[model samples]
Structures are given as structure tokens and as C-alpha cells.
Target: MQGWRSSMEDVHCTLLKLDDKAWSQWSYFSIFDGHNGLDTARKCAEDFHRYLLKSFNEMLKHGEPIDGPLKSSQLDLILFRKTIKQTYFFMDEQLRKSKTQHDESGAVVITCLIGPEVIYFMNVGDARAILVSKTGQVLLSTHDHKTSDPDEQHRIAEKGGSIWDNRVEGQLAMTRVLGDFSMDKDLVPPDADIKEYTIHDTNNPLGFIVLACDGIWDVMSNKECAKFIVERMSRTQDLCKICDEVLEECLKRGSADNMTIYIIKFL
Candidate 1:
């Protein structure tokens, strides 16, 4: 949903399943909110997954199957956190080497690697995601990487950057992102923060997960959005209509930026 934005700069990715036998049970979904221009976001949407998958596969050793633990840890998810963080740098390097190397445009990312047993969120900038339990409760949510955040502010200052009007270096609203090659690498780092959650049992499975840009979040609280979707999903089970209603509600509440959302259902 492009809303009132002059041009659509947001892009989304949804892979119901990966192609490899070991990864066949896993899926991927993401939303990239582009800023300044679309080059960075478009490039990310095109080849980002390949970079991520390649990194993941490279990390896998001879004996570790898809669900197996890494060489360093007994837990499978411990390996994924490193993979997700490392992939962010790999992705930023790719953008730096691309034809649009000088493009100042960047994107905030909210991405998920949903596997058979767990879901991992790799996020940057203000884009966010939240998981809801089967009992209609918010389980966990990603933190927005904003310049006003105390830790983000300290990191910026340590790297010779300053915040003005709550914007990083008096420019970017978020402290971390991708494809902002013009910014100082140390200041506006391209790091994807990680969040992990194990899937619940049959008695209380996850109801859904919501991923969206600040357009939706600026106007709606986490609880508000989750409640809105749960109420409709229970009554109609129409994801499309539910999304449309969300957009309309955001628009009504004066969300001027482009709006997009993904509802990953578990039940």
C-alpha cells in the first residue's frame, strides 16, 4: 500500500519454501522500506536472499543437516544469529560494489527466516515485527533502531556522529540500515539485530506474526494492530481483507507514508 507517497519505494519478499531438501521446510518473508530512492531497496529485494542463503550454506559443515547444530554450538538457533548478523555486512558490501554505489538511498529491513521449529527475525532501522501467541497475547517484538535511543546515541557519538532533531547525523532517522554508502560506516552501521523464538506446542501455538514498516507502526500500537488482525482473522479468515482494513485504518488515522504489512499465520 503506497498511501500518499509520491512514488512507491517499498518492496516485499515472500518465499513459502526454499528449494534445497534440507531447507525445504523453511520459509522466508521480508519487507524493505526504501528511502530517498528505490535503487537500494530494489537491489536488496532482487539478490539479498541469495546472499543470505549462500552465507548460511557456507557456514554449514559436512555433518550438520538443516536442523543440525553448528560446529561451535549444540543449539541450532545459536548458529542462525551469527549467520543473520554476518549476512547483513555481506549484503552491504554487495550494495557498495554495485552500479549504484553512490546512491544515498537506503532501506530499513524486517525479515524472517521461519523454520520448522523456530522463527528468527533479522531487523534493521525502524521496520518492526511482532509475534502473537494463540491466546491473543503479544509474545515478542523487534526494537526500532532510532537515533533517539540511548544506546544508539552513545554508539553514534563514539563514532563521531551526532543526532539532531532525533535524526542520525542530522539526516537519517535510524541509527542503523543498509545501502547508505554515503554515511560513515562506523556511525550508520548496516547491522541486522536478531530475535529468536521457538514455536509453541499444539496446546498453544502462535496465532500469527506481523511485519511492517513505520507507516503502519507510526499510527498503530502493537496491541492495536494485533487485536485488529486477530478479531478479523477469527471472524473471516481473510488475510487480504484484514490487510485492507488495516491500511484503511492507518490512512484514517493520518499515516501519510506508504504502508505495508505481512501476516504470517501459524494456526
Candidate 2:
């Protein structure tokens, strides 16, 4: 899913799978919440998977053992964190080499890497990643990266950055993303800085993931959505439809920004 209001700004969502070499296993799902502009979002969406694969292979070459006893879920999280770190370095170096500065473009990422026995999930920034249990309970939910997080403020200051405050006195926005090069200068130890999360054994009889940008979440509660999907599934089990319904509801609630959602059901 790639949704944009203007040609320059974009929001992207993606899904892919890594089939086990033995042809017996695989993993899938992804999303990119593009901000400032869609160009970065599009570039990241197109290159994220490839970059991660390359980064993983590089890790293997660097003597990071791939053959380990840890479940693939855990290993994937480690690899993902490593990949994000590598990508950050690669971007930083590329920008520096090109003398690029003052580019206010970036993206947030959320993903569910379905492994052999668990779902390794990760969220960076504002998008939501929810896990529903078989008994109709929310097992987990990703929180927004607002001014509430201290690390965000510290990084912003470390980068010698400042945010706009329309309220005359209050200004708040979390510090993290894909392309905001101005703030990139502050993220020392880049690899260790990217946000990551993991969930184990998510093979419930009726468990799934619903990921969407703030456009939808701004109006609907997590439980409101879970209930909508759970109750509606009795007649039709279309995740995309659920996503569309959420978008419509957001519009009804006066959201003017571009909206995109990706829903995944695990049974």
C-alpha cells in the first residue's frame, strides 16, 4: 500500500517472504509509514528488503554465526536490528559523501517476520502493531513515539535540533526515522539505535496483526478495530475490507492525511 495526498509526499506498505532454502519454511509481512515525502518512503520500501538481505549476508561473512540454537524468530530480530543499523550507516555515509543536508524526508517501519515458532515483530516510530489472542484479548500493542520518550528528546538535542511549537510554549515530537538527515547527525552508534520488538509462539487459533498509520489510529481505538474485525469475520474475513472500513471511519472523524493499513491473520 502506497497512499499519498500530493505527488511529493507518500506513505508506503509492503509484504514479502523468505522461503527456507530447504523449501519447507518461510517468513512474511512489512509496512513503511512515509513522512515529509513519499520519495524516501518509496525508496526505503523498495530497498528495505534487499538491504536487509544484504546486511544479513554481510553479518554472516563477518563471522556472525547463522547456524545457532536460538529459534528463527529470535535470530530474525537480531538480524533485523543489525540490518537497520547497517542501513543507517550506509545512509549516513552515502549522505555525507554526497554532501547532502537539510533534506526533511523519512519513514517509520513495522513488520511481522513469521518464523518457525514465533512472530518476530518490530516497530520504529508512530505506526501501530497489534497482536490478538484466540480468546479475543489484545496480547500486545505498539505505543506511539511521542514527546513522552526521553531518548527521543536526548537524541534531538544531541543532533543540535529544534522542533516547532505552535502552542507558544509546548513542542513535542519523537526523534527517530529514516531520512531526516538534519537529525541523523546525532544518532551515534547508529546500529544500536534503531527500535525493534519480538513476539513468540503467536500461533493462536484466531490471532492476527493490524498495522496502520496515525491517520486511522487517530480516530479508532485498538479494541474498536479488533472488535470490528472479529465480529465482521463471521460473515466475511477480508482484512483489506477491515482496513478500508477503518480509513472511512477516520475520514468521518476528520482525518485529512493519507491513510494506509495492512492486516495479517494467523490461524
Candidate 3:
């Protein structure tokens, strides 16, 4: 639950909490990276949470008649991705008309749901999600979204945008995201792009999640952060304290963009 910004731009928003509702038992955590302005970032963060809840409710409505054949994993990913895409489209269209964001406007979103024995993750863009295990192992991490990937580069080129030095010139750092209406319209007939990821239990490991913006990740490696967290947890095992240390470490390492982290420990 810490946020550090570099210079004046690069906005980030985060939320961490334990949930005990009638629908499920889990802890929810999320990070939002707003590119154009903090106004959109703040609103995106608030709206995403609501969108998730609505998605779950919709699943319940559609799943009630399934009897014992209901599969949470299959349903969750499908519903979550659908909900996120719909939500992003709604906001992108509204922001284009409501705000002064003449430039492309959007945000990268990463989320984690820690359930009793598994973790569900979804991400769009470079913002990351990391998991640490009790045995001091780095279990799960997401790849960044950028032009380096051939698929990403192709998408950018198709949209009449160029990727330089791993950035979307004046738009973003990745090929996919939640908004960026101006850029979307220029590149396509309707000018919109939305993406999502669904990580099943097959590849997950036994570590806490290290969710942060590129500011921190840009300067560090997946293995390096994994070792750092493992070493810290071996001593204190207090997640909040570990978060503080990770933030400072990133600053000391000279991260120039905004640095924000959402650490989720499965206890």
C-alpha cells in the first residue's frame, strides 16, 4: 500500500484487502497504471473494483442453474476478462468525451485473487504480478507487454503507431491496455484495444505476489526481486515491512518512473 512518483507524471493507484462475502473467500489486490493523467487513473481504479463485483454477480446469476457441474476456474476467467473488456470500453468512450485528453488515454491494470489454495491473476501491459513461496521461491511472474514481442509489434504497426526503445512513443509502454481512446480510434475503425490474461493453478508457485509498476521492475530482475523478498521474509515474515523494503530498494536502484507495489501473501 505504498506509492512513490518520479518527477510529475506516471500515476498509480492500488488497493489491498481481505474479503469474506457470501460468494467466496479470498483476498483481493490490484494495481492501476494511468498513462494520460491521474484523473483517469483514479477513476479507473475505483471503477475496476466495482466492475469486478458486477462480473462476479453476473456469474452467480448465470451459474445458479448449473447444479454441481459449476467450475469456478473456467467461469471466473471468462467472466473476468469479459467484464474488464466491457468496463474498459465504457470508460474509454466516456473519457474521450469528458476529459481534455486529446492524446491517447488509458491505464494498465493487474489484479490478484488469493483463494484458499490457489491464486487467480489477470494483467494487461507491463505492470507485474509476482508470487513468493514459503520455501523462499519465486513462484509466478508475468511478462511485460511491449513491442519486443512480435505479436505486440504487429498490433502496433497495424494501428499506425510505432514502438521506440520499448515505449509506444507518446502513447504507452505496451501494445495492450484498458483505454487510450485517441490512439485506438486512429489505428482502427472504432479505435479501441483491450486485453486480459488468465493464469490457472498449473503454473503457480508458493510465494507472495510482487505487483508493481515498471518503475520498480525496470531496474530489477524477476530472480533478483524473488531472492530479495525470500531473504526478507526469512527474517521478519511481515508482508507490510517487506513492502517498505522493496520500495526503498527500487529507489536506491534509480527507478525514474512512479513506483507502486501490491504484495499479496498467501497465509
Candidate 4:
């Protein structure tokens, strides 16, 4: 939802199946929260997945199973993580080389690659994601990359950057993001924070996962949003309506920015 924003700068991507062949069984979803303008986010929504698919397929050709917790040495797992990080950088580099001036703006991203037995989350800036258990317990949550984070502060400082008023150079709130070519590259990097979570549907079962922009996080705590959805799901099973209501709840609670949420259920 656009909420109170004068212009809607947010965009999203969802693919039930990433592609054919080995990728046919995988899924993808992501939120790109744009700042300054929508071009960066829109471009990411259209092209980011392609880079990911190409990278993953190349890894697959080498017999590195897409479904991992690879029993054969940990090289495969290490390579898997490396590939994810490289893809983010590659996307960023592509943007840096774009002929258009869209890179002047920026977009924070939270991307998920949902495989048969595991989920991979790659994020930058404040767009976040979380995976919940069957009983509504949050199994994992992404840490936002903002000025308030000491590590992020150090990262910027190491690059000769300064923070003023809790923003990078007092202009941007996030320490990392895609695009923003006008800023110091080391200060506002496009490096992604990647994570992995193994899915267990039998011994522990599964509940749902939530992915949203900082617009929602600005007013709602992780548990608050998760609890609201868990309780609401008991009363209704319509996921699409639930997503809309989640955005509405954020608006009513004083979120003034564009809001986007994705609720993926396993139970």
C-alpha cells in the first residue's frame, strides 16, 4: 500500500517457480523499498531474479545440489553462500554501469530463495525477513543495516564516512542498499546480508514467514506483527486479504511510508 506517501516508490517480485528444469521446484519472493525514486526498485524487481537464476544454475551444473546441508564436505555449502553474495554484487555492479541515471536513487532489498528443504534470505538496508515455526515462534529474523548499528557505523567510518542525525552523511538512514551511485560506494554499499534456515515440516512442523519493508517495522515489532497474523489466521485463511490488512494495520498505527508485506504459510 502507498499509505501517506506522495508517490509510491516501492515494488515487489514473487515467483511460485523460479524457472524450469532444476529450478522448477524452487520459489522466490522479494521486496524492494525505494527511496528518492522508483527506478532502482523497478529495475531490481525485473532483473535481480535473472542474475540469481543464472548464478544458481551455473552452480548446479557443477553437481552442487540446490537442496543442501550437503553431506559431502562443506565446500558445496561454502560455495553456495559465496554465490549468493557474488550475485548481489554483480547486480549492484550492473546498476553502477547502467546508462540511465536511475542509480541516483536507491532501494533496500529483502530477497528469499525458497528451496525444497531450506530458505535463503539475502538482504540490504532495512528491508527485513523472518521465518516462523508452527507455533508462531520466530525462528529467524534479518538485522537491519542502519546507522544505529555499531558494526554499520564502523563500516562507514572505516570508509571515511560520517553519520549525522542517524543517517549516512545525514542524508540516508540505511548504511547499505542497491544503487545510490551518488553516495560513497563504500559508505552505502550494495553488499547483501545473507542467511540460511533449514525447514522442518514434520518434527517441528511450520507456520509462516513474514517479509516487509521498514515502513512496517517503523511501527510494528517483529513479534507484534507475527502474533497479529497468527491470531488472525485462526479467524480467516485468505492470505491475500491478510497481507492487505497487515498494511492497513501499519497505516492505522502511524506508519507514514509505503508499506509492503509478504506472508508465506507452511501449515
Candidate 5:
């Protein structure tokens, strides 16, 4: 992690072993990028994982049966999506009601839940989650919620909000985020974009997954970051070192913001 601001406003969480037996072995990773202040990001880093685990446990206990003749992998994907969606909404609602002061700060979030059989991701605002396949392919990536996006612009207009110089109400550059009482609640949605992937080829395996805030992305593309990791993977499997190198590279490329990155590799 690197901070350009006087006080760093980005926070992250990595749980390599969320459950050893009950949930069939899973991991969790998240990135929270705060703008204006660190309060929102700090709050999420402290409580988001707990809420996610609670939702995961509930799903394990009373999961719905797979419809029709769907495969087990397909069923797992459906359930994971449902659980993550519930977790996001629940956390957002809780944040909203926790206290009126929370709205003064806001954050972008990207979280990943990796299970033995599948990988699930949830994104809100400009933070991203990217997957690189074993063959060095960009399998999946989350879209940034920028005010310049057509769909986002429409949503903002419908909610009586305006964009100036590609910023929401001439302030926030992102169209979706948590908190931010200064913006219209209807325009700045807390809903996240959730996706799931079934890991069928254990033999070949996936290359890695990268979860990061826009600070890093502003200086590098998904392909660039994945290739950097791939090159390093050929010589070493030290994920921590690789992340440090990436952060250094971003800084060298002139990223002037708080940076946070999380990497997960499949063996």
C-alpha cells in the first residue's frame, strides 16, 4: 500500500482461510477506497467481512436446491451470487442507519470470495476485480461506475442529479458508491455488480485474481497488471513481493492517490 494523501484513505482485508471444513474451504479479499475522508473505508474494513461471513453461513445452512437438472457447479454459482448480493445490500442499509455522520464520507468497494469450486466477485463504484486465466487471458473484469458512462448518466439524470466535467454533481467522479450524504441517495446507489465463475479445470488452474482501487488502475490497464504478475510468477510465487512491485510501478507511473491492491493465485 502507498498513500499520496497526508492521511491514507484506502483499506483492505484478506482472509486466506475463511472456513476450513464447513464451507468447503474458501477465501475472501476486499478493497475499500475512500474519497474526502477515511471514515467510510475504515468502517467497511472493520465490518464488511463479518457481514459477508454471516451471509455465507446462512446460505450454507439453508441453501435452496438447484432448479431442474443444473450441474452442481451451476448451483454453487447461483447461491454465491445470492449471498453476496444480500450481503452488499445489508451492509449498505446498516451503514445508512448506523449514524447520520457516516454519510459525510464515501467509498468504492470491490470484494472477492474464492471457493474450492468457484470464484465470486462484487463491485461498487470505481474499484475493480480482475481475473487472469492460466493461459494468460483476461477472463473477467468489473466495470467502473463513472459518471461519463451512458447508463450511469441516465441513472443520475433520472434521480435529479447532474454531471459536470465527468463528475457527479461536479464533485465525485464515480456514479455509484457507499455513503456520501452530500449526493442524492437515489443517484448514488449502494447496489453492487456481482458475478461468479466456476473453476472447472483444476489441472490447468487460473493464473490469479487482482482486486484494486482506481489509484492503481488509473496508471495501468487490466492486461498490463496481469502481465506484470505473470512475468513475476515465472520466477517466484511470492504474492506479497509482486504486489509491492506493482505498487511501486504505479507510483513510478505517476499515480497521485491512495493505493490498495489484493492478489489471489490458484495452485
Candidate 6:
């Protein structure tokens, strides 16, 4: 839970202990990186968690069990995925209808929900999340949505958009994001890549989950970040100090963009 901003355009939220009575065991964390301004990022930090909780509650009302058991059926898993997707859309729609004008600004978002038996994540734009094993292996990581990606390029072209200088319409660098009303809605949709992982060996432990904006990723590889944490944890158990060291490392590596990193250790 440490962040360093080269500018004031980055925002983050952390719920080390979420207070939802229905899902008391869950915790939430997220990072929002604003491109043109900080309005969208600030708004997301303030409201996105509420939207996610609301979506989860709606699914619970429909008989989707999300608590008290470690085992989840296939149907329950599907319903959870749907709830996350709907929450992303719901947040974006709210941003669109906001009283503040955000035609030129937008944000990249990465959010994670940690439950007793599973960890769920949703990512949009270039921000990323990674799961590292105890042995310093990268088990999973989210992909960045950039114009240079073939799938993103194809989608943009299909929506009557062009990429030049590796930017959408030669302006925005990311292919997917929230807000940015100036970009074509179809080209820059608010769709997020949702994923979940079951925590199987809680006794032996899984490792760590690292959520960060592109600023850190641009300078450090996934393995490097994980190894850094592992080395620090071996000596001291100060997670906050480890995160601060990571931020300093990024700055030493000359990361010019606003930087944020959130680490969740499973051990």
C-alpha cells in the first residue's frame, strides 16, 4: 500500500478490511491512472467500490452464494463473473452521466476482490495485476490494451478508428478505458478483462498478488517485482516498507509517469 506520483493525476483505494456484512471476509484494492486529468481517477476511487458491492449484492439476492464456503460450483462462478462485468459497465455509465465534463480525460483501472476461497480481478486499459507463486513464479498476469496489439488494432479499425504513432486516433495511447467521451464509444469501450483464481493450498500458501499502474510495469518486469518482494519478505515482514522500497526502485529506474503499487501477500 504505497504510491508515488510524478504528477497529481493518479488515485487509489484500499479496503484491507471491507465492512460488507453479507460478505465480511472480502477485501478490495484498486488503482486508477488518469490520462488528461485527475477527475475521472478521483471519481473512480470514490465510487467504483460502491458499484462493485451493489452488483455483488444484486447477485446475492438472486441466490448466488458468495460466502461461508470455500467450494464454488460452476454456476456460482459464472454468476460472479457476470456480476463483475456488469459492475464495470455500471461504473462507466455513471461516469458518462456525471455532472462534470470529462470529454478529454479518462483512466485505466485495475481492481481486485479477495475472498476467503478465491481472488477475482478486473482490468481495463494498461494497468495490470499479477499473481506470483511462493517460489517467485508468475502464475498469472493481466494484459495491457494497447493499439499495437493486433486484437485491439482490429477492434479499433472495425469501429471506424485509426491508429497512428501507436495511439488511438493519434491521440489516446490506450485502446480501452473509462470516460474519454471524445473517443468513439465502440472503439474505447469500458469492457474489462475479468478473471478469478481459487486458493487451493491455504496451508502451504500461494504467494502474492501485485496490482500496479503502468508506471511501475514500464520500468520493472513481473519477475523482478516479485523477486524484490520475496527478498524483502525474507528479511523483514514489513509489507508497507517493501512497497515503499519498490516505489523508490521505480523512481531510481527513471519512471516518469505517476506510479502506484499494491501488494497482497497470501502467506
List TM-score per model, in order. Answer: 0.93, 0.75, 0.77, 0.93, 0.88, 0.91
After TM-score superposition, the amount by which residue 175's alpha carbon in candidate 2 deviates from its true location, in angstroms, is 1.7
What's the lDDT for all of these models? 0.84, 0.58, 0.62, 0.86, 0.81, 0.83
By lDDT rank, best first, the candidates go 4, 1, 6, 5, 3, 2
| lDDT computed for candidate 2 | 0.58
Per-residue lDDT tens digits for candidate 4, residues 1-267, read: 899999999999999888866677678999999998888898899999999889977887787355633322323778788888888888888877873744477899998888877788889999999888777788789999999999999888889999999899988999998988888878998888888877754666679889999999999998888898988898899999899889889989999999999999985
Flag clash pairs in model 6. none
What tens-digit string does per-residue lDDT give for candidate 5 at 1-267? 655768788888888777554543567788999877777888888999888878866775565643332233544556767777777777777777774654588899998877667777889999998999876778889988998699999888888889998898898899888878677778888888987777886655688889999989999999999888898888888899999999999999999888888888877
Which residue runs does candidate 3 get wrong by more than 4 Å? Answer: 1-21, 65-81, 100-105, 169-171, 185-205
Tell me how candidate 5 scores on lDDT.
0.81
Model 3 pairs in collision: 105-180, 130-209, 130-210, 132-206, 132-207, 132-208, 133-206, 133-207, 184-191, 185-191
- State the lDDT of candidate 6 residue by residue for 1-267, as single tens digits: 234544677799998656647666778999998888878898999999888877777777777455553234423778888778888778888888883653577999999888877788789999999998888888889989988799999988888999999889888889889888887878888899987877886543588899999989999999899899999989988889998999889889988788888888875
How accurate locally is residue 175 in candidate 1, as Cα lDDT from 0 to 100? 88
After aligning candidate 2 to the native by TM-score, how far in Å is the CA of 122 from where it should be?
A: 2.1
**RMSD to native, candidate 2:** 4.5
Of 3 and 6, the candidate ranking higher by TM-score: 6
Error of 2 at 73 (Å): 7.2
Worst 10 residues of 6 by lDDT: 66-75
Off by over 4 Å in 2: 1-4, 11-15, 19-24, 62-80, 88-103, 154-172, 187-206
Q: Model 5: which ten-residue window has the lowest total lDDT?
A: 66-75
Off by over 4 Å in 5: 60-80, 100-103, 202-204
